[model samples]
Target chain A: MATKKKVTRKNTTTNKAKAKTKTPEETSPAMDNPYISASFWKAMWIICSISVLLEFFIHRHKHFEDLESSVLGNISNWFGFYGMFGLIACSGSILLAKGLSVFLKANEDYYDDTP
Target chain B: MRIITMTLLNNIPPAFLLIIGAFVLLILPARARKVGAIALAFFGVYAVSQLVEGSNVTPEFLGFDLTLLRVDSTSKSFGYIFTLSAFGALIFSWSERCRLQNTAALVYVGSALGVVFAGDMISWYLFWELMAISSTFLILARNNKRSRLAAQRYILVHLGGGLVLLTGILLTIHETGSIDFTKENIYQNTVAKNFILIGILINAAAVPFSSWLPDAYPESTIFGGVILSAYTTKTAVYTLVRGFPGEEILIPIGCIMAVYGIIYALLENDIRRILAYSIINQVGFMICGIGIGTKLAIAGVVASTFCSIIYTSLLWMAAGAVMYRTNKSKCTELGGLYKTMPITMVLVMIGALAVSGAPLTSGFISKTLITAAAEHQNYLWAWLALKVASAGIMLHTGIKFPFFVFFNVDRGLRSKEAPRAMIAGMSLMAFLCIYLGLNPGQLYSIIPNSDILVEQVSFYAIYIKHFDHVATKFQMLLFSGLSFFLFLPMLKRTRTISIDFDWFYRKGAKLLYSGIDKTFNSINRAAEHIVIKTFLPSLVKFIINAPASLTIMLFRPIWEESLSADKTNIKKREQKIISQFSSGTFPVAYSAIFILIFIAILIFLGRSLS
Candidate 1:
């Protein structure tokens, strides 16, 4: 019984040492999370709101006033030309690049033998 | 004393100073060499600026007057960037002990300067080949298998282009009896014009040949990449502006280059390769601007080329710094670097923003000019493509480069900041980025024909008063950031590089060579059977058995051998010859075949002459 108690004490001491050596990041569950924090989401919301609010307050200029105005051009002048066209362009390019990679991406060794 | 001052003021091409300085670098003590190279570069810049506008020199070579130097607005602008690039690169690479690289870089930059000031087709071709050869050494200076192979491919492609360019120059000379390289209606479907365009487009990284830039640039040494990024494509752009401005076909070609770069960059794992593709993308805009052919468009093209040199060099410097510190380039292999390498991260981000045309940066000032010109010319499709490409720039270069390489996953790498020399180099570029952004007038005034525009329109009215423009730009950039994060999962870094068209050359050539070898093997077998089995045996029998005076005199057998022995000897020789006919076994025979062909050519020429 005494020997068993001594082993348990030794185990507990090792556990304490392990805990002491743990990184600050490992100790805190909140910090260890790889996902973006709630604060980031809140900040993003504020940025999005500012984009919308600025468009409403500021007077717009016509781009390419001489040429036949594009249909998308008229729609772009609304509450964000508003953030809509830019967003679509941004997301559209990303998706397009992604689609391209489906056929194009290969292992780094794709040209290994050549160069 | 007056003569000395006159000589300094003489229209001596500044390329002489740099080319001579390259040789001088080898003799100078290591410590002085760096300082000497830098001084030479700055002096070259001064010399270029002092040059007067005219056909400066007509050095006679082989009875042909080659215009060795021409100082004009276009040449001056290009010379400005080329010399400035040498200065920045020398500063960044100060710690590199390889004097050979120093020499190669000097020669590379010197030759590019030569191309800029070259007035005649002959001088242009000379400098063009020199630029290609010298830059190959820069790639080779890395001294690794990958770099060596890349350098080999690089030289082969450049030499091929140089050959095409030479043919075009010769044809032009033959047809027009002039060696001048001035703007002409070269796009009227002439073979010479098409060849010249193809040669220039290869260097510009347009479409199919675009693979070479990304294939080679990433494999360059750290500082070599910075210098490499500045010269080749920009020189091509300068040539295009000089030779083929307003050529309608270029607009579509340029658009393809722009979009293609973005696509390849999005899938690239190596940071340097991404920047390489970005070079194509940026050069594409300039090409498009040149195609538009308006004064504002040309100015925009020049400004963008100039701004790109600064910002792109900064990115290369930053990426080199990261690679120098961590010895890693793949995005997947690098992360949490911002914690240790904050300065590098910050500098890289500044470059990123500049390239993405963030508000109040060099890119915004330059890229907008081109888009505005496109709109003014009513190239709606081109304008729209440019806008989309701008967003794509934001995706791959602006956010992806910094976010993945520095901020994302912490790979537990702790490294010191870039060396002080590199930091100084990057700081200089960053300062220019912001300075030019705030006061584009400094750049605008230098533009050859923008003097009138500069005086009339307040920059504030153009850039700031249009609340819609600024607001829309901001929304695009900021929301692009949003989409990056929202779609971060799909954009995760992977250990892969996208396959490009070089696969056709690298793999397709192998297939071709093998196919030819297989066909040649069968032909060889049939010829061998006829020669060794039938013809040689019958000839030997005739010689031995005819017993003529000629046969007796030639043979004079050393030993009294039986007829059977002689026949056995002939049979053994036939077997030996047949065995030697195995596939690719007789390398000596290949040389013999070539010799025979050469002799045949000589004989044919001799007979024709007689």
Candidate 2:
């Protein structure tokens, strides 16, 4: 019943900007540069800031202990060891995608308007 | 111990009642069935809280196996809320006559109940799939082409997750070799750990695979949408709590979902679709609590799981009401509905507040705990993000939904409120949300740790006491004040469907599908053209020229005379045969075999899983 053209646009640019603010890909959706979108750079700084805070402050607890017995405990030792590495490696792929976007992106409509 | 045993005993009667309800709804007369379902559902709900005897209560049938029919405080609470979901769903479907819908919803709930109480992975898997299949039937009962397609896609994604889950199960069994489905932080084998995480994340409707929900749900039948709101995803949530609590990724994934849902919903036109996305958002909170992985956080997840069930169903109840009455769900098509359907409007507003995590609603008690848990874990960014998204929830669900659907200018039409049963069904939930929020201590007791009560009870008290806390007293006053101002600009009557993630699939991928379809079709035509017009014609000319060329091929004169007579009759007969075989449709055997082979593939899949 309602038509799209009749619906007034409300600062589409700003609205999209706001939506991007909380998006999960805010830091890096692609890999290469990882800083392609200005918003993503800002989100990264935010993450780095918070993660630094968490590691330094909250993790400063004496609860961390090494288990010398039981098979389950030994198993957790490996996961704690490897899972962190896995996360870091996966994060690299994301960073690279962001960087590579710079080279692949061509002039607007390189397929059509240029010709 | 006695308390656990009694609770286990309490659960058995309801299980029997539901198993019976599942069959009765299929075999009985329609009118008689509705009444029977309601009565059975009521008693089943009552038994959830009444029969609890102890904490480690297991009920075994046919010997020696321990089945924790009633286990810990958390399981009991989930079991109780799931029963509540079952009751509400029964009432919502009271007038819905699709026998398949009723039967499927019944067994779906029972299977989910089984999952919650299951003490083993094998049992959980059985119930997990039962929920998936029965729920798919509910979607298919909508009996539309779109729903049928969505159902197929839905099954594919879930079945994929199921396979991954099976893979995880096998690996875990190989390593730990234990079937006990209790909590385990066994990320010992990285491969098995990631497999389980991926499998779990898929069902949790975390990224890349979240499309099935919003895509399939809105296409479901009238009340089909109701039961779809529960069971499947939450069962996955239950599994995550037991299997992978305190895992860090769930925090980020869940937070992403919380914000993702609101943003996409902000752009969506379909109310049911928006609410479907909101289900992910709510489940996100539960998963986040599990990530925090503490006593308070688990309590938060359990309470929020129940709140999501109640509030999500309530939101759908109102949206489904609008669709049922007007046959329109897009916000652009709906407005000023509050004038005609006051009760629906009021219930919708209440549902909206609960959804926005407004103070003094069920959401407040359940959702606040999750945010607090994140803060306790010192996830400051997540904390800040969740709070902003909380406000965004207000904008998207709380304000935007009600504002556009009801409060926007009149569309020059009138509509009736939902059926009496639907209204009664929603009212029960709206009442509970407030009842639980104001009296959160009542809810806190069911959460496992004793320490939870001491910390949370006081926290809720501060909020409750702030301004004549009569549950709705503070909420109503606060909401009216906020809604009257912040949502003013968004409430303008001018309208359009905001763009969303589905736009990539619904519109963009649709364009891709159609483009690919056309390209293949034309390529097929071009190939046909080359073969039929060129190669086949050349072959025909060659065949005609080869042996039958001229006089030699024409046999001797006398033999030719006899053959000509015979050939003339044969030509006539052949003409008649051609006329008889010609029909303007695919042969019956063609369609039958095509469908049969298609089903054959599904059967193959089922076999392969074993």
Candidate 3:
């Protein structure tokens, strides 16, 4: 993926040079030189792992005790329930937005000539 | 001198001080304007702080008692923040050269303070409209065509909302025979209550009427955007908490707005528009808390309003700084800015984290109170939806805003740091975000209904006493961060806008205009053709020939008997007489003779009948 981005950048730069125009892509550095290093990703992963793991040692109170015990016992009480719920909720909202964009998205000038 | 100062402070409303100072600032020389504005704002804050509880300044107007300076816990909380933010915004815009914008900002801030302290519906309505009118100049001060158009639409919508509020106030006054703005008087008239609610909801940017914020705020000047973000909807939220607490309908409306804001922000390209939409989302939490009406929920709403104003303004300041230096506001056009503008990047990240309710930020402390209030009341669905909205906020604003603007693929843009004034202003707000988060007690002690809130469900005690609660929040927020990276590929920025409720007006207004043009204009044209073109000319012709024809008939027998002539000569003589009468050559004698004869015939018929 990184290699493909670099190739695209090179082609765009050549095209921009031929046209003799100052494009943003021409001034921008290659996409391969990422500002966020590999160490940052590792640190983030470790933090996430610890957060999920800490849920096990902590005693959680049941906000919906009766409903949880009767219908789906201990599911919300599980160690990574909060983490799993967060993950699902975030992804689900993104997917929903993607679907919504099909109908709602328009060009930026959609209302410019409205009158 | 000391006694005079004390009397002045005690008797005068703080709003009046700021308003009067605005006019005074306008006359000062250019160089001293900034100092004047800052001093005025600071004095305004001092006056608000010195206000005693209960009504301080009550003046009679047209036989109605007007409470211009009502100091209660709620009003004081809002007054303190409103004036403080005004002071900060004045500092932020210290270098702004537009004199009109400066005066307008002062008046806008003054009117908002007025709304907070007003105790009568008449005074409240007056200040409400004043706020709407003065704030429009902030957008207009951008002085571009787009900003002009946006300001036009902004004022029209606000004025329309003001009319609706006035109608409700009038009806309530008529029904109750009093103009007090208390909750009981408002609830006295059922129809008036709903009208007032709808009017306030429009200002609150509740779902359908919410498009005005995103439509207008992004078009304001950089500093103007910072000030704009703090006041308008929050004032509406203040009114909501004051007037319509425990209205169950607000729960659903707030939930929909919370999710609606996130969905649109996800697809938005403009960085400022994204922030504008998030304003709607944040206000959703406050509105939902008001719907709960629990002492804890009201406390949460007040605390969050204070915190949200600070963090949101900080975010706008950062965005404004970038726009000021680079002259770009699109997320797709901005990137790698973090490399050069590190201070701005850090401040913006702090704001983003605070908005996402990260553990040690203002959002975490205040937002939890609302959700916890929901849970305590056994509102399982509201609790779940709020949790989802919280995570969604993390995705849209917390991660998406900063990443796209500063840390996305480098676009090779380089710029200097924001102005010293802008940086100082943002730092003040950033400090407040963390300070309030770490010490909830400081915020809790100032929020309205704190005594009741502590006795009911103490948010302060919960965080201080329970470690698991903090851990649970961390687990959710951290995992949401994990999900963002996992799905980073799908979160691509596009040069597009998402259609919102404003489309009804932006596009629907055009449709309405054309429809009216097609329907009514055509009818008008047809009427013009019949009346002026066809019917009027013929009527004039008939009127011109009528007297001649009538006279010819009346004189035909007389001419036939009196003249001895051939048929051709008789015909010629009659035609000549008719022409003379039609041309007015016969003078007034002919007309007078005909009129006398007609009247004599009418009199003969009357005598015969008698």
Candidate 4:
């Protein structure tokens, strides 16, 4: 997604002056206000760390205790399985959505207006 | 039978109060209308709250007993939420001057309550159609070209569903000679049952027919969209629970809808359209629960339905406030709205977390019931799919909605806060979302059937003790959030929509209509050629020549006799004939003269009329 930055003359002049002082890469729009900033990712890392560690101490019970537990089930029983599964599922779903969009995406005006 | 004193007053169904309230609001002076509507909401809630199960009021309609008001725990559970939603929506739309939108919204909500309370199939059908028609006006009330078109499509799809449902009801009645709204021995293979299921699925926004929800909902007026998000699908869920619990097929259908909604929402750019898709995804969870058919599962369906109605409506209301203030709906066109509209953003976040099943939120408690039920039933595949879908929900709705609309790169747009009325309405629902989540006993107590209630209570009591289950859910959601940032590039908003089965009807129907038109045109063209090249000219020639030819033939014999009598007589007759027939081809000339005169006269008459 391209972020729309309104470039007024005053703002442009300030940016140009700043460009004279700062490196071009630092002045790039993408670097200036990234959608997910370094600060946000830092917070995310901390949250993930806490949650990943917390998974170890939690005691969970299964609804179907009598079901034949297998290797996959045993693996899921390990700590952080849900976290790992979620990461994989989320990534997979995003990729799947992107893949589906290749076939299903169309011009927003696919339905005409004249009726 | 117990004797009742308030036969006329108390027996009046809450549905009628709302219907009557709509008319009363319409008639009251403009200054008094809002007050009148608020009063009606109060009365309606009170009326519904007072209703007792099994104390049905049956009215005779065409020699059949019509259950106009069948109060039960199931009906009351739905009634409580429906009336509550109406109250919130009424306050949300308090500033609306359009009487039609107001009245229609009331009728729409009232009819949903009626469907919830209806004890007979015929009355259900009547209230069902009333819902379809009245809700349509909410879309049409926008009165713009897009809304007009969307409203038309919306009604057509609903009417189509309504017809299918009416067909099912009629068939069931033919087979069983009863119209009571109770469990019937409808087999999976039966045509009537399938018809009924498909009809309800259409309203539920289940797969194949699901596109209508996204197609039409985003186009409604703000309050209209808010009210619309509440009743239609939830009523269908209520009906499904009443009509077909444990059907088994709904499990797969629901699972598909759950994932399908996520994929579509992932690709959507419009904020409200994303919310609309989430409605489908959330309902899918409920439907899956209903399919499990265990007491816990059914309770989950009812509880989730209740929670979904509030949280989804809140999401829409918050999004609507943004659109109202900024006049932009597409995510690509919105960002940093939180700067000016902080309250709206906070409310939306609350709705978002609630929908994502965050701990101590309505969705967490309600969704667990279904997932746990799937586990108890040993439906491993369903349990896994639902868990993944749970993660998917957090991705698409819980984060995507607020991230794009409020927290993304600044679009440099500023706006005033949402109006107080809208804020009040959202706050009420936001409070309820947390209240219901933190204390689910209030919600569980309302689920129909005593047996189900007991099971639900035990399930609730036990589920909280499972630290692992709660921990896993949090891990999934937190990791899902992590995945979202990792794949942020792939999830960029785009100004495109994913085409679904509606393509068949929206485009295919256009193709079919034009094909019919082309066929008619070709037939018309062939007829035009025959008429113009052959029949028309021949008829014209005949008409012109016939009169002149007939006159000439009739006078010829008399003229010949006069010519033979004397040269002097012949000379005068020949002079007269020469003067009249100066052209060499006299009959052809006469035909032309007649044709010109006939055409001139027709033109003269045509001109005179104008």
Instruction: Report DockQ per prediction, comma-separated.
Output: 0.30, 0.02, 0.38, 0.37
In angstroms, the error of model 2 at B566 is 68
Question: What DockQ was computed for model 1?
Answer: 0.30
lDDT tens per residue, model 1, B1-610: 9667556756689888799889988899998999999899988888887787888678898678988788878788888888987898888888988888888889989989988888888889888999999889889988999899999999999999899888888787777777888876343338888889889999898898898899898988898899999999999999998899888898888888888888888788899998998898888888988888888888889889999999999999989999999999998887778888888888888889999888778898888888888988878788877877787788788888898788776677789988999998998898888888878887777665676456424558556776567777788788777887787777876788888988888877887888999899988999899999899999987765443333234433521254444766655544544454433355686569758988999999999999
lDDT of 4 by residue, B138-194 (tens): 999999999999999899999999999988888888888888777673342289888
C-alpha TM-scores of all predictions: 0.83, 0.66, 0.83, 0.82
Task: Give the top-scoring candidate (lDDT).
Answer: 3
- DockQ for candidate 3, please give it: 0.38
Instruction: List residue ranges in candidate 3 displaced over 4 A.
Output: A1-39, A66-78, B1-4, B452-464, B519-610
Kindly list the per-residue Cα lDDT of model 3 for residues B1-610, writing each as its tens digit. Answer: 9778877787788888888899988988877988999899898888887778888577888789898987898888999899988888888887788888788988998999999999999899999999999999999999998899999999999999998998999999999999887889999999999899999999999989999999999999998898899999999999998898888888888888898888888888899999999999999988998998888888889988998998999999888999998999998788878878888889998999999998778998889889988877766667777888888899889988999888877777878888889888888888988888787777888888788556324445656467687888888888788787877767777788889888998899999999999999999999999999999999998898887777678877777787754668678877887789666677688678878999999999999999
For model 2, chain A alone compared with the true chain A gives a TM-score of 0.27
Candidate 2 per-residue C-alpha lDDT over B1-610 given as tens digits, one digit per residue, 9 for 90 to 100: 9878665656574454576678877888988878877776676666666755443445553342445464667677777888887788778777788777777877777778777877766666767787788889988998877778778878877888889987877687678766566556336566777787788788778866687788788889878888788777887888888888888888888888876776566556677877887887777777777888987788788888888888888888788888888898876677667778899899889989888777778887777777767766666566645654565566567766887688654564378878898898888888887888777788877766646557557544637343222332222323332432333433332234333344455456667888999999999999999999899999987765553233234334544576675766655544443443343244587569658988999999999998
TM-score of 2: 0.66
The positional error of residue B299 in candidate 3, measured at the CA in angstroms, is: 0.4
What docking tier does model 1 reach?
acceptable
List candidate 1 segments past 4 Å from native. A1-34, A69-79, B1-7, B185-189, B455-459, B519-610
- RMSD for all candidates, in order, please: 12.7, 18.4, 6.9, 10.9
TM-score of 1: 0.83
